[model samples]
Target: MDNCLFCKIARGEIPSRKVFEDEDVFAFHDINPARPLHILVIPKRHITSLATIADTDTLVLGRILAVANQLASENGSPDGFRVIINTGRIGQQEVQHLHAHIVGGPEPVGPMLKRV
Candidate 1:
């Protein structure tokens, strides 16, 4: 996992616009944002993807969701937001580490695009 980008971020080896962090999770602004308000929530542990999550990770996953909600409310998008977790190569998951993307605000209106 030494080459994993998110692991580096969670370990504070790389800088991020962090919005929240605790013993179990980390949330931060996405460098390549898809919406006006975009954030990435990730677990401190190195879980490859949702497909690989173990039963013990259930509570940690729940904690990540709760933290995402708190972040959305604090970031001025209390009304609603979208959370996404790309699972594999076909799902467009660039980073091997599991993470959730929180996006909200006016939906972008344009032609269908491959990239978010």
Candidate 2:
């Protein structure tokens, strides 16, 4: 996990525009945002991806979701937001570490996905 980008960010080895941080979770603004309000919420402990999550990860995982609303409302997009967790290859996960992206703004984010 030493080399994992999100772990580095959680450990403060890398700088990020942090939105929220607690004993178990870390939320920060995405450096390259896809939406007007975009944030990345992650666990302080490294978990490869959602595909690799274990029962022991429940608490941390729950904590991630627990803080999403507050993080979004405080940062922006109080009306609503989208929480996305891209898993493995098929999910188009760009980062190896498990993280949920909170995206929204004054306007809708458009359709969840395009028709295949």
Q: Which regions of candidate 2 are displaced past 4 Å?
A: none
> What TM-score do all the candidates reach, one by one?
0.89, 0.96
Tens digit of per-residue lDDT, candidate 2, span 1-116 = 78999999999999999989989999999999999999999999989998899899999988988899888888778999999999999999999999999999999999999999
Residues 1-116 of candidate 1 have per-residue lDDT tens digits of: 88789999999999999999999999999999878889999999999999899999999999999998999888967888878899998889989999999888655423434776
- Cα displacement (angstroms), candidate 2, residue 40, comes to 0.2
Estimate every model's Cα lDDT from 0 to 1: 0.89, 0.92
Off by over 4 Å in 1: 106-116
TM-score of 2: 0.96
